[model samples]
Target: MKLKVIGIIAILLVVVGASCQSDDQIEFKRYYSGGSLVYQQHCQNCHGDKGQGLSALIPPLTDSIYLKNNKRKLACFIKNGLKGKITVAGRSFDDQMQPDDIAPLEIAKVLTYVTNSFGNNMGTVTLQQVQDDLNNCQ
Candidate 1:
């Protein structure tokens, strides 16, 4: 009876763990797809569909050096556009990030899209996270 109970418990744990894992995957997928649509609507033209950027006006998110270093700065900059010249991966972008005119949810969606895209592998940026950060913006 003891062995049977232990085996059943182990199986239950495995099943529970797998279910939780799948839920996370589904969440990520939702964020990814939503992000893609938001990007297409707000960003793709200047940044390129692949995030390769265009000339000196926009910076590519695919550049690992820039993405890693500027993740937080990028989020804040998205909230409030940066002016003058800003360099990424030794290249400069002189244009401003259009004020993320969308609702907080849309802004969060697009940020998640950029973070997950362009070969950058950051976790999803939740709407709550964006909301919290935006509350502190200047």
Candidate 2:
């Protein structure tokens, strides 16, 4: 009886531990899922359903290097819009991206989704980070 009880407790512990997600993981999932919705509503029109931006017009989101290098500026770009010339995927794009007047939290969520989707793996772009970046926007 004692051995059986110990085994049951061990099994329960394993199950519980396995099912538990770290705070970061939980937050990532929340942001990613919420961002998905935000993307569909706001970004899908220009960026496309697969993030493959319009040819030579809108820059695609699949450029991991650009995303990583400009990770901090992304929040500002989203909130304030982008214009002029920029290079993505070794191609130069001179176009205008209208500003999205979304809340900082929504920016964070959508950024989290964009940075992690379309062959990107930039992890989570937290709300705090987005707010900080927005404050420093040029």
Candidate 3:
């Protein structure tokens, strides 16, 4: 009877633990989910649904060699936007992505989604990180 009671208590603990989530986790979840919509609306046009750019016109986000190499400066790149010539996947794109195309919150969401999607799994970009990037934009 004691063994059965312990097992039941363990199960209850598991259930309760599963239900409990920290506030940061909830916010991250919200950011990640909202970022998907922002990407579809704002970015799907140039970047494509799967992040495959239009043949040298835009850069693909699906398998970002750039992101892989330049993770630190990525948020700034997003906030301040990109110009000049960039090479990705052995192809070159010479275009300017407008700065502040989306609001800062949406930028965080979009970056989080992109980093965690399309053959990339870097990590999440917090609102604080985005704000910091904005401060240090180039």
Candidate 4:
């Protein structure tokens, strides 16, 4: 009887662990999965499907150390665009980001996707954080 009880407890623990994982997966899908679509529509054309960036003209956003330090600037830069010069991975990109005017929520989604993908693990970019960042920019 004791052996049977131990087996039942082990099965229960497995089921509970699986349930917790599903919840995390749902949250991951809500942000990263949705953000991917936003990225494809707005950023993929220039930044490449994998954020590899175009040569001479555009700079890659993937695994960007500049981005890690200036996370707040991303939303503003993405929306209002970046002109002049910027450095990433020791390379200089002197060009235009071309102001996109994407919505605040879209910016958050894009940032979340960019900062979390492409060898980046900057974590989720919340809507409120984007709004605050944009407000501070101006």
Candidate 5:
């Protein structure tokens, strides 16, 4: 009976732990999972499946510093598109990234994915943040 009780307690602990994710964690997971689909559909073509980018043409998403520094501008870049030259991962890319015209929520989701995946950890890019950034696009 002692072994049975121990097993029951263990199962309860496991179930409780599994369901203990915080609200922010839940939000992040939702954004991350949705972003994964968005990335595969919209971004994977040019950025590559692993975000490694094309050789010397497109910029890789592996650069965490670039992502953090350009966090605010990313929404603009995505909504309005990007052109001209920019250095990423110690290399120059002058390729043009055409506008996606996706919604603000999708932008938030994709940004959250990119900034968290591929060696980055910038945390959730909330929809409100994306909307604010979009409003200030240059």
Candidate 6:
């Protein structure tokens, strides 16, 4: 009887594990696809498809220190465009970053991609966060 109970528990665990990939994960998959398209069109030319920087001109987003340390700054800087001096991952970037062209929703999607891809582990940037920052800027 104990052996049977153990077998049942094992089956239950397997069932639970199989169902762990839920609808939310599907949504994330979609978001990642959309963000990939956007990045390919806009960012890949300079940042490379894998988020690696173009030497001293463009900075790599694959570094976790830059993403995790300046997550909010990255979002805001992308939205508003950066000018003058800025530092990330013990390096300084002084170029002007063009403001994001897409809407708040699209911007959030792309940012989510950057935050989750390469070597980054940051969370998604919400549409509300983009909209609010844009409003505050103007």
Tens digit per residue, CA lDDT, model 5, 58-88: 8999999888889899999999999999999
Off by over 4 Å in 5: none
Tens-digit lDDT track of model 6 for 4-123:
999999999999997788876766777777888888887888889888887777888877876776655665676677788766656888887887657777777788898889878666
11-111, model 2: which lDDT tens digit per residue? Answer: 99999997798999999999999999999999999999999999999999999999989988999898889999999999999999999899999999999
lDDT string, candidate 1, 16-111, tens digits: 887776666777778889989988987898889899888777888788777667655555677677787877768977877776656788777787
Cα-based RMSD of candidate 6:
4.3
- List ranges where model 4 is wrong by over 4 Å: 1-15, 21-28
Output the TM-score of candidate 5. 0.96
Question: What's the lDDT for candidate 3?
Answer: 0.83
Candidate 3's C-alpha runs over 4 A off are: 1-17, 20-25
Candidate 3: tens digits of C-alpha lDDT, residues 1-138: 999999999999999997798877777788889999998988889889998878878889976677878766777776677898878888778899876566778888998899888888866788788888778766
Q: Each model's RMSD to truth, in Å?
A: 5.2, 2.7, 3.3, 3.3, 0.9, 4.3
Quote the lDDT for 73 in model 3.
Answer: 73
Which prediction has more favorable TM-score, 1 or 4?
4
CA lDDT scores, all candidates in order: 0.78, 0.93, 0.83, 0.85, 0.95, 0.76
- Candidate 4 lDDT, tens digit per residue, 1-138? 999999999999999887777654666658788899999998999999988999878888775578888898889998888988888867889988889998898888888889988888887788889999999985
Off by over 4 Å in 6: 1-20
Candidate 4 accuracy as TM-score: 0.82
- Candidate achieving the largest TM-score: 5
TM-score versus the correct structure, for each prediction: 0.76, 0.88, 0.78, 0.82, 0.96, 0.74
- From the highest TM-score down, the ranking of the candidates is 5, 2, 4, 3, 1, 6
The alpha-carbon deviation from the true structure for residue 22 of candidate 3, after best TM-score superposition, in angstroms, is 5.4
Task: Return the number of clashes found in candidate 1.
Answer: 0
Total clashing residue pairs per candidate? 0, 0, 0, 0, 0, 0
Cα-lDDT of candidate 1:
0.78
